[model samples]
Target: MDLNHSINFSSSSSTSSPFDDFIPLDSFMLPDCDPHLSTKEEEDDEAKRSSFTQLQKENIDLFWNQQLFEIQNTPVRKTHHEFPIARVKRIMKSDGKVKLISSETPILFSKACELFIMELTLRSWLHTEESKRRTLQHCDIYRAIRNDQLLDFLVSIANLF
Candidate 1:
């Protein structure tokens, strides 16, 4: 590209980046620009910057939330009105009360406690680093089910079915 085109591209590129675009290098008192002074001007600049950042964050969050909602709401074809064989096997093969929690993206459980322990155990285990203990202690699992956070996510999944 020509020098003029390259410079233009670079300037636009810095602005387009999600993180860096919010604050241009020069705007942060880079040696090239006239120093910004005065409390009112600084406050105004700060306000503008924060507002822009907030808008950007909100827009990005909304975009992902909508995308997730779309995916969550998408319909699936059922093969036989019976649960998929893989899912049935997965649930049946689980070691204990965990089987009560279904893999059906939208989960359903007859007992709240059954759903709670299983979902949290699955999520916590998956997020755990390999070096970390694979299983949570029994007390923690009991507490998690008591708190119901696990049940909530499970219900969200169950509702999908």
Candidate 2:
């Protein structure tokens, strides 16, 4: 019934607190203490960034050229209507506001999907050739997106960038 009697404050005694060893704010060195140091650091960073960007651009150009050469040398293959119609129908149904889908919609969607896959594969193959690798990687896709500014915008709008 007595609330004050149930609490005990002075049960243990430890003099040194955990934060006692911390250095004062005034004694800590500021990141930009020297103006010249910051300027030099910034210059170095800019140079590194520009060099990296140039390197990336060169790589992208090389890949693109290789893709062009391959395209010229390779024989054309016949297109097969392999896209799944059921999957396209399911996608069309995902929109709650649209209840009905035209019968031709699925065919168009399938063709679009095929084109999208082909484009992605071509871009990814370019990356593979750039890296001199046999298999494609996620980094290849990321680099491809980065190198293609238009694709970058599309990806950004799609929230994938």
Candidate 3:
């Protein structure tokens, strides 16, 4: 595990990352960005970033639009969930408070978990765009979970990422 092979840090007194790999330290400046200048596009982006609710609403609208397209084009689709019912049942049964669950209950839970994963991935992608990165990072997902109060339940899990 050679440090030079993975990450290369500059020796300059002023912390300026050349973007060899990774976000490198705390610097959030996008590539080729001039700190002193605020262009029209940058100002427009700043305005968009200021309102989280509007962004969330837009995302939800896009999701529903896609869903409607799917519904219209494919009238008959099988009920499918990415989550395995067996795994969901095992998790549901893990809690001592739960004694027994009906057959349909596990299926519903599996579908719910699948929907949650899709929504979380969508939200995380938004964060990735905010960082101006083509690739998704753990921090992006962490920021997504942190920003949404409804996702507070996953805060502990996100911290590990």
Candidate 4:
């Protein structure tokens, strides 16, 4: 080969160049933008979300916060619960070291369990929505748990696959 060969600076043939195709920024789609390009399911999801009034949306969006506020302001009750207090008591007493549990313990535990469940489900539902999925899968729960540092204790139980 020649020591000082000149590199070709031009294409003589009619084959199209890679950069010939112009891609405008508007051509690229993003979430919740360009509704005309959205699928039926996406439209339905949007409609559902839009159906909620501003106040309802605010309450839903700040569910955990609102729940904490209500708990702090409300008086404690001993009326058992929607969740069976007896079952909660049984589960608590299942531990070998648990010799005695106060009457109030089961009521509190049952309420706590209900609150925990609602919070976790809300978080997992958010993950499902983020993934643009209507169904709440196990992975959503795992993702929710992984995303929150406080839920790290559940990470071992909810293995990411």
Candidate 5:
């Protein structure tokens, strides 16, 4: 009933104190500082990244190698057939006899053969099953020449020069 009686500040044997502030048993000190990420988690993450990069490099290399292999293994058609006309004319100056004089632009027999083969293959592909026989045009032959088209054009220039 008394104000002084209710506000009891002195701790006696009978009354328990409820104000208990938390205090850590050990003093708070930062754990040893690692200059680099030295934890197991960091190491695992770095290892995973390295492995992923290595795998990606290997896959890229394999893909490129396979592409190169396919390119190298592709079959190139040869020219030697009769369907498309392939000719190499060479004119050598002569006094009805032996001495070799100035000669015209000499087309190699091997190159002529290659041209024939490519031309024939293209003509064959273009020909239908019913009508196979047809006179292959020189223009068509030139058009069908795939790889050496530029070379042939250059040679024509060289002959002019």
Candidate 6:
């Protein structure tokens, strides 16, 4: 089969030339945007950002106030074995040389432990509020742990539990 015979050489009957069908690229191009127009959009974006930040701060403050209210309204009670006195004695004993713990030592340690727990809970709750969350979560505690370099060891130890 001849390759020349396979191809059609017939001319089109249409009157429109190739240049007539062609569209100018500039016509399809985007119009020049005003620099001032973007500045207006930027101002709008800045306003939205500031408003969002203010909203978050307000939420945090509200959460903190609610927590403070709850703390004030709640009655403080002293419960027996609330702080694991025996565990404290064991820990003191585990120091190798000190095999015996005085009876009064456990009682004082228990009170100290209670205070420590309350303080840590308050701090962790504040961290939660800072994140604009009303409810406290474990991640808040983790964040607290991470924020304090002294608690880095506790973070690894607490993960086991």
For all candidates in order, the CA lDDT equals 0.49, 0.68, 0.77, 0.76, 0.46, 0.69
Number of the top TM-score candidate: 3
lDDT of 4 by residue, 1-161 (tens): 23376544357667654445656565446445656555877888877656533433454569968888988998987774868988888898899999899998888878788888998898788768767899999988898788778899999888835
Clashing pairs in model 6? none
Q: TM-scores across all candidates?
A: 0.26, 0.46, 0.59, 0.57, 0.27, 0.44
Backbone-clash count (model 1): 6
What is candidate 2's lDDT per residue for 1-161, written digit by digit as tens?
24456544553566544344766666356554666568789889899768766765676577568757865796643343557777779988998987998877787678667656666666766677657899998777777666676587656644454
Tens digits of per-residue lDDT for model 3, 1-161: 34566555769758755464555455655466677766987887778777755777699679868866865786442366577778889999999999999988987677567667778888888888766898988887898899889999999997776
Q: List the residue pairs that clash in candidate 3.
A: none
Q: Model 5 compared with the native: what TM-score?
A: 0.27
Q: Write model 5 residue lDDT over 1-161, tens digit each, in one string.
A: 34355555665767654333435555356567576776887889888757755654565466557656854795533443333322332223233563543222222344345555654454333432113446655443433333244346534544443
Local accuracy of candidate 6 as per-residue lDDT tens digits, 1-161: 24355444447866444445566678449677776768789889899767755754565567668757865896644357457777888888889999777787887788667655765676577677667899998887777666656567788866764
lDDT score of residue 126 within candidate 2: 69
Query: Between 3 and 5, whose lDDT is larger?
Result: 3
Off by over 4 Å in 5: 1-29, 32-38, 75-161
Can you write out model 1's per-residue Cα lDDT over 91-157, one digit (the tens) per residue?
5567565544444532332223343344566434433322256666644444433444434544544
Is candidate 5 or 6 superior in TM-score?
6
